[model samples]
Target: MEYRKKNSITGVLRGATFSGLLLCMAALLAGCSKDPAAGPEGGVVTVSFAAPAIGQETAVQIASAASQAQNGQSPATRAALAENTTVRVVAFTAATGNPVQANYVAEQTYYMSGGKLVPCTVDDNGSFVAVAPDAKMELERGSYDFYAITPALPLGSDKATVSVAHKVDYAASATKGVTVDASKTYTLTQLDRKCVRVTFVIKKSANFTELTALSVTPSGAGLSMPNLPAAQSVKMGADIPAAAGSETLTVPASAFTNTDATTATAATVLLPRSAADILLTCDLTYTTATGSSRQTSFSSTAKNLALEKGKHYTFTLTIYPFDVSFTVKAEFETTISDWTDVPAPAYPYVSEGRYIVSRDALGSSDQPLHPDWTAATMPAHNEVSAYNALSSEFEVAAEDCNSADASGVTPNPGNYQYTWANALPACAAYTQAGTSAGQWRLPTIKELETIYAKKDGLTGVGSFTSYYYWSATELSGASYGAWAVDFAHGNTDGNGKSSHNYVRCVRDI
Candidate 1:
């Protein structure tokens, strides 16, 4: 009986020892355990993308502006990844020793929806605003290699070999030794696009009244993948015709929108990354204020242009009139830059009741100008009326200076008061707001009246005074008299050409 009691006590002691050991182990495990937010050993793998890098050649290079085309057309445009861009990601098991031994493990496709990558099966119902959690890629804690492609190309037998045809948009990325730890999110390097964006910036001169239509065809253009092995030919794909040889890309008129009176986004195209002559053929159809229809064809070749991938190119073309047909002294400037949407051109600084002042009255450094004028025998009232009825203020202003003296004589000869001849030359010589010579002219009687009417609403016009202002229109019946407007009283009357008065030069918007 005494031996049995001893055995029972020993058994109780053994049980207590086992319970204590269990408690200690439980406490130790609790201390080592960490919350998922505290960087655990394994968690969800969240993917992100880095920003794209800018090209090295960012300056604009000036080249010949001669109008000639291989196939025909012209440049400013931007191409960007679409919001709903689909991306296929192939994950490979990292090699234990050599990275070259990596083996493909799994692959999945995701789409860019609402600025975030989501699984393909997660239907957003086309709203793109479906409230869903970010895609979670559960990967074991290990190093991995990833290959990503946009528009999700079929992964054929050769994984390392990529086939890029002459497509408008394409991007690819290959990342090696991407360590995925439960500790933090893994971000993929930025995808590199295989094409360049060319934007054509069309600027209109004062002579360009309207742009009825415009189209561009880029000839001898093809795309290539330069990121491949140097020993391998950059060109691939025997099945794609565009990849075999140069192809033509046509930018329709619908892509270009006239944003303002001066400029328009002519066309934007995604050109291939091949070294070839970029020939632009541009066809323009429009009408001039001189009552002539103009159809101009401009073509130029950017020789041996090895367009860089992911770069934006801008080709600016300013409209030149062919009526005079002078040698085009101006040349085109090629600029490498980031993709940007052309801002609308600002114009019509002031809105008159009927007329718009594109810029402030011609003057010195935005100051109010008053120059006297004297012209030979002025047109008769009937003749002046007929001229006004037949032409615009811009036309009348040009004709008013027909008899301006060209003897290189000093203006305001005898006194500060300028004669009619001197006034014409003075207005013709003045330059402001980047205007060329002979662009500014004396305001007509009707124009002066409108300016006075909308004086209060002048937004960006130069300073003005409540004084008599000369008009391009001559007095109806006087031989040496012209019409003038009194801004103070809104009175209109005939005045002698020798009379000293304020002059306000203007140009067509």
Candidate 2:
């Protein structure tokens, strides 16, 4: 025959139809040395599509449903479709056998999100169909991948997919941007249910191309808490530790202006805990894609936030007090007459006079006075003065009662032979200058405390008692009377000088 090619064979066709025509052309062109469309189509032969062999697995098949239909094949030649027609091609060094879902993009739009795009879905059922199969369609043309899921198909192993490789794509949009914005605060309905909700207003709409995600950041995204004045300072009705409070804060939409308000709400989320002490201060901040920040202080007694005095607390911050300091000094004070509601002196006043007592109470039980009860210091051997009482005989030193012949000190020969007469001269000299002067007069009961030796509770200021001594401190309204510190149970007691006690005046260096 001369020529007669079907018009359908020469025109534009689908992958299957075009593929069939190309096959015929290739066969016919093999014999002739002519251009494909240039020669006659007389030798065109009638042929049928190969049978879709019934195999355990659809790995072997001549054509898919549509292709079989177009080729006018019998159901026997058209294999009933299997749930998953894995139309993947072998790849070099790629996973050879894994039921791995295919990565894909739309053939029409070539838009795929992570090689897997979910069609609009319904709650109870799958509604989408596969648009492309594995690496079957123009594999080398774009990024090829095995189809992952068909929403219209059953889930689990029951799913059938049209794997596809898509051209690298993006969410090319009208605009692209990153922003930090606060939400226009609405009535923050703190649902008693454990949540704080503030309606935010969108300041603007941002657009981006190929962008798959958006991130929002909140700078000063915190609840406007009331100044947490110290619970003690606040004089709260409840225990300071149990005081409770809250505040109504005013927020504006401009806080998150220039972006989607919803995003602003999500980008910058503020949280306030009832259990936590909160500080409320006015705040404002801004940001780009990088970050956001804010500053505030707490209202409390110790001059700062309820933050712990010696505790470790942390937060996203620029800087914090690792150790801060200041200094102070303390002191001791007193006033002798500061007693409230009490008289200064508890004893009655007395006048100088002579009194009699046992010889021992004067100086020694058997000693004699150089002169008499009112006797004055008399010059004599060793310049010794006569003693009046035995009370201090064992307590007072011989030198304290007498002046020396040549040396500054003069003492007795024996404890019992010591005569008050020997002490008179020194007593007179001291009296002339100033009776019992310069620690040379008489010993205080306290000083007498040292009369004994540290040896056997008999020494040092910690021991010694019984002897009556003189005190420079005059009795209130009385010249000759004085107070004395006694080692007897370590107390303060008194007696008149002539009633006869020891003399040991104190001298300050």
Candidate 3:
């Protein structure tokens, strides 16, 4: 005889006649078989399972219950459930009708397809079709208990030991006693998923630029739930490693707003329900603008968290910059008021003045001041003295002073006791306003030594090469020589006037 197939088997059973209602009631009432429905020859029982009727209200209750179970507090608002992907069904038979402790009957898994439960089918060639909807299983007629779970269980040993592969698995089960009644179909509902839904919302401070990685691990007791049958306790052995099993989630850029309003959200994690509190430890790694890497960790333990089945918990974490420490060099005051006891005092010489030494050696204007100390051309003794008659405040050419041409290929020397004093005013970088036009000159040996003494304070502000710098002082008896200061060791020595050395112009204001 043909049997009538109905849509939404769960909804139909909810409004069936009193006799049909008894059969429906038998689904959840384990072992209660009063007057079994008679079946055709061979007594074959047909059973079908469907997805739970998860409405917005039911979704909210599930989320609320989950939050209260995993954390001592419940969310102010309810949350929506994620999409259902697959379903699993298991059958058990016992003379006493207690499915939880009865003998294993049969088991099959199905996946969601076109909004229906389809059993996984295998082809003749040994290839398996992973999903097929409305899968029905025929079993020998008897009073048998049935259980159905969602997101189908992973393939493993047997009903006594089943493993869940997903990071977050939503599991629901319904136990019903079915008696074959001329090809009867039973729809399963009110399955309690034995897991908690957890969503993590991570945020970073302004000082942090990129979030390299984030990891969450549940530590301490309560990692496993007692709701599972004792015979199937071995399934808990498949628990994900605490430190490992970090979700491969990408935190979107929009989640990093300055107002701490932006957040990177992780997909829901299906954690096993527990009777005790579970502590979650989270680690964050990030980068900074200065090319520095930093790490921080947070630990939150909900006191007395009795994780109930089918609940949801949300966690919001805000990461701040780590405290950093550094040292700054002290600087000497830049003012100097005395120029007394000097030889060959000139007309524009003032008793009191302020002087500034060039922080960098002359170099090509296109080069960076800090590290690029090499320049194309440098003036020597003869070129500096040739301009002595013109004006003390002469702009010195960038080429070698001893060279006859601007190309610096031909060497030429003038009077042996040459002074860069006349050429120093040309270095506009070191010259100050309201001072004698030619006052900007090469520093004396003593003045160069003073600058060397305060080198530490000028570290970042000035770029000084560890070479010799030209000084205004001439070697007392050496006609062709002048004194130069070694910036490397702060030593003064006499060198040929025509010899090329670095120049750091100085000016008094």
| Each prediction's whole-model lDDT (CA) | 0.48, 0.26, 0.43
For model 3, residues 1-509, the per-residue Cα lDDT tens digits are: 12344545645766666677787678757434433334244455666655444312244445577767788875333212233355567777734533333377787766555655567754322123565555567777766666665555543444644544334444555555665455545666544444444445555544444443333322211222223222123231133222223333322333332333334455343444333433444554445555566555554433334433344454444453432111111111111111111122322111222222221111011111111111212223332232111111122222222222212122224421224443243332233333333334455554455555655544423456687777665666776887787878888788877675766554332
Worst lDDT 10-window in candidate 3: 360-369
Task: Write candidate 2's Cα lDDT for 374-492 as tens digits.
Answer: 11321212112222111212223223343331134343433211222223333323422322432233322323333322114322212222454444333454544555544344445
Model 3 lDDT at residue 35: 30
**Top-TM-score structure, candidate number:** 1
Query: How far is 388's C-alpha from truth in model 3 (Å)?
Result: 67
Q: Candidate 2 vs candidate 3: which has greater lDDT?
A: 3
Tens digits of per-residue lDDT for model 1, 1-509: 99999999999878778889888999889856955434546554544443222122213311322232333534222223456666666677765432222376666566676655565632222223233354545566677877666655545554433344433345656677887765444555456555546566555544434444333322211212222112112211111112214344556656666666445564343534445555555556555555466566665444345555555555555553322110111112122234433232233234443235322211011111122122322232322452331111121121122223222424444333345545655666645544555566566576676667656665455545566777777766777888788879889878898887666666543
Error of 1 at 3 (Å): 35
> When superposed on Cα atoms, how far off is each prediction in RMSD?
16.8, 37.1, 27.2
Q: Which of the two, 2 or 3, has more TM-score?
A: 3
Off by over 4 Å in 3: 1-42, 54-84, 94-97, 100-102, 121-129, 132-136, 154-161, 164-166, 204-262, 268-308, 320-509
